[model samples]
Target: MILCFALGIANMFHLHWIILFSVVCLICAFIILFIEIPLLLRVCPTSPAFDGFIRRFETNYMRAAIYFAMSAIQWISIAAKRTSLIAAAVMLLIASLFYALAGVRGQGFVGSKTLGGQGVAQMIV
Candidate 1:
């Protein structure tokens, strides 16, 4: 990611890195929406009250909506051309926040105690 930013800066005269950045963001959005959602469905059971597909859809709607919005915004930025850089930056920040939230969703807060503690377990946040 730092490499992407460095190259983007180095090529600022043409603003070509905006294309690369948008493409990467689009790829990430696909993985989050298509790949991760299906994988999560396999891990988590559907609600008994609803049909399987409907339950899966209901359970995952918020995550799907967020990723879908991120993807739409990135694609729209690509089309905007003149303000693509600013758009990309905003989208990237949103993507980073959501990704980190998903990654840490079930983990205890940073610096929290570990199981079977004999001593403090180091945590890096």
Candidate 2:
């Protein structure tokens, strides 16, 4: 949302498509994340730890992608370098923060060794 808003503020007419695409992606991501609940009750939903980590990773990745894309677009469309620099900074910050956090978490959740011969992991998308 922040990324989208920032792009709009940078150049409202130029970034309208980017903003729309970002919103649509966000809505789809939310729906997929929410839909995981029912799968939890099914025979072989992913372990909570793995699922949680995946969700968080995906969410943060999405945010970072939006920031990066918007930053590039704004930098191309607008003359102001400062706005682009700020967006780039925010992108780096978010990407680093979430990935670092995910790594710390995945260590505990993903376990040291992989479990072989487990059921096939089903992905919605």
Candidate that would win on lDDT: 1
lDDT by residue for model 2 (1-125), tens:
44534443443343345444334334433333333233432334567775554355334345445444444443443343233434534554565466456555653323211221123244332
Output the TM-score of candidate 1.
0.26
Q: Write the per-residue lDDT of candidate 1 for residues 54-113, one digit (tens) a residue.
A: 334322334445545554555555554654445445655565566557555753322213
Q: In order, what lDDT does every prediction score? A: 0.44, 0.41
Q: What RMSD, rounded to one decimal, does every model reach? A: 14.5, 10.3
- Candidate 1 residue 90 Cα shift, in angstroms, is 20
User: Which whole-number lDDT from 0 to 100 does residue 75 have in model 1?
Assistant: 52
